[model samples]
Target: MKANVWHGKNKLQVDNVPDPTILNPRDAILKITSTAICGSDLHLLDGYVPTMEKGDILGHEFMGEVVELGSAVTNLKIGDRVVVPFTISCGHCLSCEEKLYSLCENSNPNAWMAEKMWGHSPAGIFGYSHLTGGYAGGQAEYVRVPYADVGCFKVPNDMSDDQVLFLSDILPTGWMAAENCSIEPGDVVAIWGCGPVGLFAIQSAFVQGAERVIAIDRFPERLRMAKKLRAETLNYEEVSVLEALKQLTGGRGPDACIDAVGMEAHGVGMVGAYDTIKQAVRMESDRPIALREAMMACRNGGTVSVPGVYGGLIDKVPFGSVMNRSLTIKTGQTHVQRYMQPLLERIQKGEIDTTCIITHHLPLDEAPHGYDLFKNKQDECIKVVLKP
Candidate 1:
């Protein structure tokens, strides 16, 4: 099998690796058909996560055909097409029953990590680091499916992989981000980072009845996408984000704000991993730059949702700036399974089309190229899907 590995800082390479085999009773094997590169992958590429090794497999979002199943796996059978959630979860956990799948006890059960929250704390993720349950990634010809019954969601035979690929991460992330906002009809939402997550956050906000969504990012291409969605796009390079945010909401900041840009923010120039994030806090710059801005831009008594990943300790939080505002802050990794089925139904009904975010489709071996394009934001590349 071939895969893209993160050799070091700003480096990626395609390499041949061993194929995966069924390892657990709940596991399944998938002949990967489509997989996506996400903003999260960039974090690993830049060494933001500690456990990513020299040859970590590098994809998470994917929809593929099941090739085999473990003895205990019953929900999914061979030949079924499914969209896999980036988070590994067990449906029988307390959290899973409550629909808080991200905190599923069987997977993580009590673990704070995404994989464990879903199922088998030992059930590693596809392409994340060892610390993240180091399950092999799907950025290859074949991937081993762990906790099959609790992980992959069976897609309708009529649906296209491209249309539902994001269900694995970003689309549901957007829905989770929106849910964090607690927005009411006619509410205003401001999203930082126009990347796919933020873009979906914008659309999802609209779907959730946000009357206006203001998108913030430095990229012209992303801003253009925001414009296409009728979201008011603001280039952070052009104006003071705080001032602009204030202006957009008629002197009141947006009712809700979401930070889709996580640890690898725009300004710090890929400042290493979660452990090194504390260094960012000491600087004058915002730790989670987007998160802080979103908090600062949130209306008094409103909410600020951070679907973006944030780690490391902070020295400065701009809390003083947002103080006296009685703001509510909501954040965490997306409870992907919670939204998967509902969003899948929406996709089946044509209420949302997330495929527009996918710009490059390449063979599994081209994973490095896809990363370069996505990381550099070049050729207007937003999402890249790898076919194995």
Candidate 2:
């Protein structure tokens, strides 16, 4: 099998690797038909997330036919097309019972590794780093899916893979971001970043009954995409984001703010430089530029929803403002199983255009080029889908 393998910082190669076999009673092997390069994957590519090693498979948003299934997986059989959630969860755990699948205690074999960093471990994610379970990702021609009964969501026969692939990650992530906002009727939501997740956050905010959504980004193409969803746009490079939010909300700030841009936010001026210097010197692992702005821009008593990925320690978080303003902070890896079925219904009803953000398509062999384009935001590329 050929896979996109991580070598080192800014290095990836399409290499042939051994095919996966069922390793657990609940496991299934998928012959990947479609996979995507997620914004979070860039973290691994750039060495933001720790514990990644050479030869690690690198993708999580994927869908395919169940080529083989283990005996314990009774709900699915060969030939069933399904989208696998990135978060690997055992069905019987307390976390799964409570529908917080991402925090499932039984998934991550590398839990202790994560515990050392985060004090608690998250669910195993396909093709993330060793901090999560080191499960081979679906970026290849095939992958082994553990706890298949809980992770695979079978799609309808009529839908294309492109329409359903994001059900595996970003779509649900964006939806969860909006849900975290707890948008009230006629409320305004502000979102930072205009990438795939950010664009979906904009649309999902509308679906959750937000009367107005303000999108912030420096990319004209992404901002235009947000506007297509009826969100007012602000290029952070052109104006003071804090002042703009204040003026846009008539001095009250947005009811909620979503930081869809995670650790790698392109910060402006000295603060950006400070974060870069700190991170480069190994003093900080993430840049919390968007998070700081979100905390400050949110209205008093409002929610700050984070759908972005942060790998490690951050510097200079504005805890004072959050404490003073009584802001509620909600963040986590998306419990994708919780939202997949409902969001799939939205896609079936034509309410969400999942394909609108996809700007490039390439064969799996060209994944290296795709990654470069996406990482640099070249060619107006917001999303890239690879066919394996």
Candidate 3:
């Protein structure tokens, strides 16, 4: 089987790898039909996330036909079309029982690796690094999905793969980010970054009853997409973001601020330069420019919602500002299983269209090109889906 394999920093290749077979009684083999390159994947490609071995498979958002099912998996059958959530969960665990599937204790085989880094471990994610779980991703022609009864969501026969595919990641991530904001009707929400996650965050904010959403980014194409959803956009390069957001909100600041741009955020003055230098030297693991800006621009006693991916240590976080203002912060890897069925119902009801962000579709073999295009923001690429 041909799949996207990670080599090292800024390197990915399509290689012929052995096909996956059922390794657990709860596992199901998926003949992958559609998969997406997520923003988090770019962190791995750029050497931001640690413990990624050479030739590791590199994808997580995917959907396909169930080709074979293990004896213990009774919820699905062969030939059933299904979308697999990125987070691997055992439904019987304490975390899963609370609907926090992303923190399921039983799934991360490499939990100790993560514990050394963050003092705790998260759920195993498909195609993420060894720190999360050394599990192979779904960027291949096929993949083995563990805990199938709890993680796989079957889609309706009439929907196209494009319409349902993002349920595996970004769509739910965006929705969760918005839901964390706890928006009251007519509230003003501000979001940083206009990438796929940010775009969906904008849509989800409106869906959750936010009266106005302000989107911030430097890319015209991304800002244009946000505008199409009626979000007022700001090109961070054109104005002082803090002041601009202040003025836009009548000097009160936005009610809630969403940082959808993760560790690779481009910063402006000396602070950004410091982050770049430290990141290059391995002194810091993430860039927190958007997070800092969001905290600085959020209304006092308001919420700060983070859907961005951050792997490790950050410096100069404004804890003073947070304490002084009494701001509430909520962030996490999305519990995709919790949102999968409801968001799918939204898609089925035509309440949301997830395919609006797709800008490129290529074969599974062209994954290298897809990664380059997505990382470089070339050719106006917002999202890329590979057909295997």
Cα error, residue 292 of model 2, in Å, equals 0.8
Off by over 4 Å in 1: 108-124, 266-288, 321-323
Q: In model 1, what lDDT does residue 136 have? A: 75
Candidate 1 per-residue C-alpha lDDT over 1-388 given as tens digits, one digit per residue, 9 for 90 to 100: 7767678757888888888898889998898889899888887777656556777777888888999899998777789998898877767767677777665555532233433222234323567776556667888778887778878888887778898889999999988898888889989999888899998898889988899999988889899998998899888888889998888778988999888887666333322443343343222343336766777778889988888775344334778766688888887667787788999888777777788888899987778888889999999998898887
Report every candidate's CA lDDT. 0.78, 0.90, 0.90
Q: When superposed on Cα atoms, how far off is each prediction in RMSD?
A: 3.6, 3.7, 3.6
lDDT string for model 2 (248-330, tens) is: 99999999999999877732211112123333323333333788899999999999999988765565789999999999999
**TM-scores of the models, in the order given:** 0.90, 0.95, 0.95
Model 3 agreement with the true structure over 131-177: per-residue lDDT tens digits: 77888999999999999988889999999999999999999999999
lDDT accuracy of residue 62 in candidate 1? 80
User: After best superposition, candidate 1 residue 333: deviation in angstroms?
Assistant: 1.1
Candidate 2 residue pairs in clash (backbone atoms < 3 Å): none
